[model samples]
Structure formats: structure tokens, C-alpha cells
Target: MKRSRNEHNSSQEEQEFLRESKLVARSPQHKEKVKQPEPSMDEIKQMLRDLKKDLHEDMAQIKREIQNDIREMREDIKDTKKELQKNREEMKSMAKEITQMKEEWTREKEELHNKIKEVEDKMERMEKQKIRNNLTITGLPTNTDNEDTLEEALEKMFQTELLLKTKIRRAQKIGQDRCIVEMVEWNDKIKILQGKAKLKGKDIFIDSELTRNEQKIQKNIRDIAREEKKKGAIVKVGYQKLEVNGKKMKWDHRSQKLTEANKLKN
Candidate 1:
């Protein structure tokens, strides 16, 4: 009787295990676990690929922006170079214009100088011509009986001393002891000037009348000429010139020095 009861207990345990197994297989929670699964390697790889693509797009956009900036900078540098080149060219042109202006000013100055020289020379010649027929006599006795006219007295004096026929255009007492005589004839003026040696013993001096400027120049030349004359040079002075042993000297308006008469520059 104990053996039969033990077999019956063993069969009952097996039947209970089969019933639990069937219930687990048929449950909704167990079916849902069976349907879902962990991700595969291929799906993970596709997500990684999408992330890489986005990163590459961002890098490409940044590269394009940098390239545009570089292009703009190069354009600005090119514009600056052109502006500098234009400025340099303008400077060169202005310098050339300035040089031309200087040359033009120099030429005008020289022309003006020449014109002034010409005018001075013409004036000098005209001034000398005016005094050519005139004579100045110094050391004449003024205390003597006064004649009716100075022209008569001069004519009488020349006739008595040198037997010269005197024909005077005008005559006057210039100072306390001097006389001025103007002759009508140039030849007579020359003759009287040359014949002054005949009146040397009378303590009188004779000279040609000159312009004030020429007289001053003559005085300077006479001073130098006198010194040279004492040293054995044949020196003589005219109104505006001097001759020392055939070498001529004249006053130069430009140089302001007594230079050689013939060799002065125009």
C-alpha cells in the first residue's frame, strides 16, 4: 500500500509542472517581451553616419565664410595699391610743373635785367650829349669890375689871350669864382678845351660840364688817375671813363665797379 501511494504523488507533481509551463507560454506580458528586441549593429552604424554628415556640413559652411573674407581682403589691398600708384603719378606730374615754372621765372628775370641795362645805357648817352658843348671855368677873378654881360667878358678874355674868335651861346657866373660857358659850335668847344694849356700861367682851370653822376665818376677816376700819373702812367679821365696808357675803364652800372670799358658784358 505504501508503494502505490508514492507513484500516485510522483504523477501528480509532473502534471503540476506542465500546467505552469502552459500558463507562462500563453501570458500577454511574456508575448510582449518576445516581440521586442535589443538594437542591432547596423542600426547604430546608420545613426553614427547621420551625425558625421551634419558635422561635415557645418565645417563646409565655415570654410566658405573664411574664403569670402580672404577674397574681400585681397580686393581691398588691390584697391589700395591702385590708389598709391595714382598718387605717385600725380606727385611726379606736379614736380615736373614746378620745374617748368622755375625755368620760366629765371628766363623772365634775365629778360628784365637786360631791358633795364638797355634803358640805362640810352640815358647815359643822352646825358653826355647834353653837356658836350658846355665848359666850366674855375679860379676866375670875381672882384674885378663887373661887365655888362658875362658873355661879353668871356668873349673879350678869349680874344685877348689866344686871339680866338669866341662865339658863345650863353655864359653866366656860376659861383663866387667860377664861370660857365656854353658854345654854339661843337668844334669851338673842342678847340677851347684843347687850348686850355695856353691859359695855365693865369691860375685858371677849365673843364667840360658833366652830369652829376658822371662828375662823381670822373672824380673817382681822376683820383686814381692822379696817383697812377705820378707813378709814370699816361692816365687821363673823361666824363664817365678813364684811359691809362691806352687801356680804357668805365663805370659799370651793374657791377658798380670801374671796369675795363670795352670788355663789359652787355
Candidate 2:
């Protein structure tokens, strides 16, 4: 009975040891299998914060791109505005030039109109003077000194029976040295005088016929006057004579008197 009791006790001890070994083996396996506690709210918040930081970084990058695009747009707008201003300035200049041209054209048109009117008036004056009794006499010496000399020369050249009438003084401010010879003609002696006069002299020039029929005689006279002016010669239109105190003084008489006085004083 004592051996059985000791053996039973030993058996109980072996069972206890086997239970402990099994418990030890099961503890490592259970520890490996055991689930850890869920993460704390703080840790989840940290992970979310990291994710938000990445998202914010992405958003910041997008914002930077948008800002650069906006800057480019602003630059484009500035350039467009500058171009527009330049174009406007050019247009203004062109418009000014056009206006100046128009004004110049208007002035020129007025000047042309005035010139045309002057020409028309001159033509009308010429047309009205054509119907007068015109006389033409030739064969007077080109250098005849006075109206009497010219008439005498014409009389000698044209052996016409004509009585001398009063001299008609019709001179011009400018023209050839010419005078109208007044005479009463028997038959057509005046016609003979007109047909036979030849102008001849040294240092004298005269035209056989008046330039243009008597219609443009005034214009011809003006032309002749202009020519005489260039030669420093004065043209006289009426019975003009050198005078002292308005009395007609003969050139020869004055010179002869001056010579006689000088001779006596000497």
C-alpha cells in the first residue's frame, strides 16, 4: 500500500510536469497567434496627417502651375495692348497726312480756278476790241526821230497825193518806235502807203506788219514794252517831250544854248 501511494504521487508529479510543458509550448504559439490592440487614434491621425501633407504638396504644385499660366496670360495681354497702341498711333499719323494732302489739293484747285478766270477775262477783252477801224502804214525809217520825220519819210516812199492832217499821237508804254500818220488821201493813196512801207535802219528793228491783226495789238504792245524795259529804254505813249517847268523844250535848242553860254563864259 505504501509503494502504490508513492507511485501515485510520482504519477501526479509527472502529470503536473507534462501539463506545464504543454502550457509553455502553447504560450509561444498563442503569443504568435494573438492579435495586437487596434492602433490608437493618435497614430491614425499621424498617418492621415502624412497623407494630407502629400495631398497639400500636390495641390500646391497645381496652384503654382496655375499661377504661371496666369502670369503668361498677363504678359500676353500686355503685349496685345502695346501692339494695339502702336497701331492706333500709326493710324493717327496716316490720318493727319491725308488731311494735309486734302488741304493742299483744295488750295491748288483754288489757284487753278483763279488762273483760269484771269485767262478768260483777258480773252474776253481781246475779243471785244476787234471791230475798230484799224490803220496800218509802213515804209517809215526805223530810226526816225520824231512823228514828223516818220510821216515825211512815209510820204516820200509812197508818192501818194495826200494832204497832211494833224498828227495823231497813239504811242504805247512799250512797242516799236511807231506813230500814226494822219493824212487826207485822194483816191486810195492810204492803201498805197500801207502796201509800200519798208522799215530800214542801222541799230533799229521794226516789224513790217503789226503782230496779229489789230485784235491783239494791245498784247503785242505789252510784249514790245517788256522787251524795251529789258534794254533800259523808256517807252512813251503820247505826244511826250522833254520839258523844263512843263514847257516842251527842244533837245537841239537846249544843247545849242548850253554850248553858246559855255563858249561865252570861257
Per-model CA lDDT versus the true structure: 0.83, 0.53
Prediction 1 TM-score vs. true: 0.58
lDDT of 1 by residue, 1-266 (tens): 36697798998999999998899898867665446687789988988999999999999999999999999999999999999999999999999999999999999999998998888778888887887789998886665434447777777777787668868888777688788788889888888878888897898888888877777777787788999999999987776678889999887867766799778877
TM-score of every prediction relative to native: 0.58, 0.35
**Which pairs in model 1 have colliding backbones?**
none
lDDT of candidate model 2 versus the reference: 0.53
Q: Which stretches of model 1 miss by more than 4 angstroms? A: 1-73, 143-148, 161-163, 201-203, 219-254, 260-266
RMSD of each: 11.7, 22.2
Model 2: colliding residue pairs = 138-197, 139-197, 139-198, 174-225
Q: What ranges in model 2 sit over 4 Å off?
A: 1-43, 132-266
Q: Looking at candidate 1, what is the lDDT of residue 168?
A: 89
Q: Model 2 reaches what TM-score against the true structure? A: 0.35
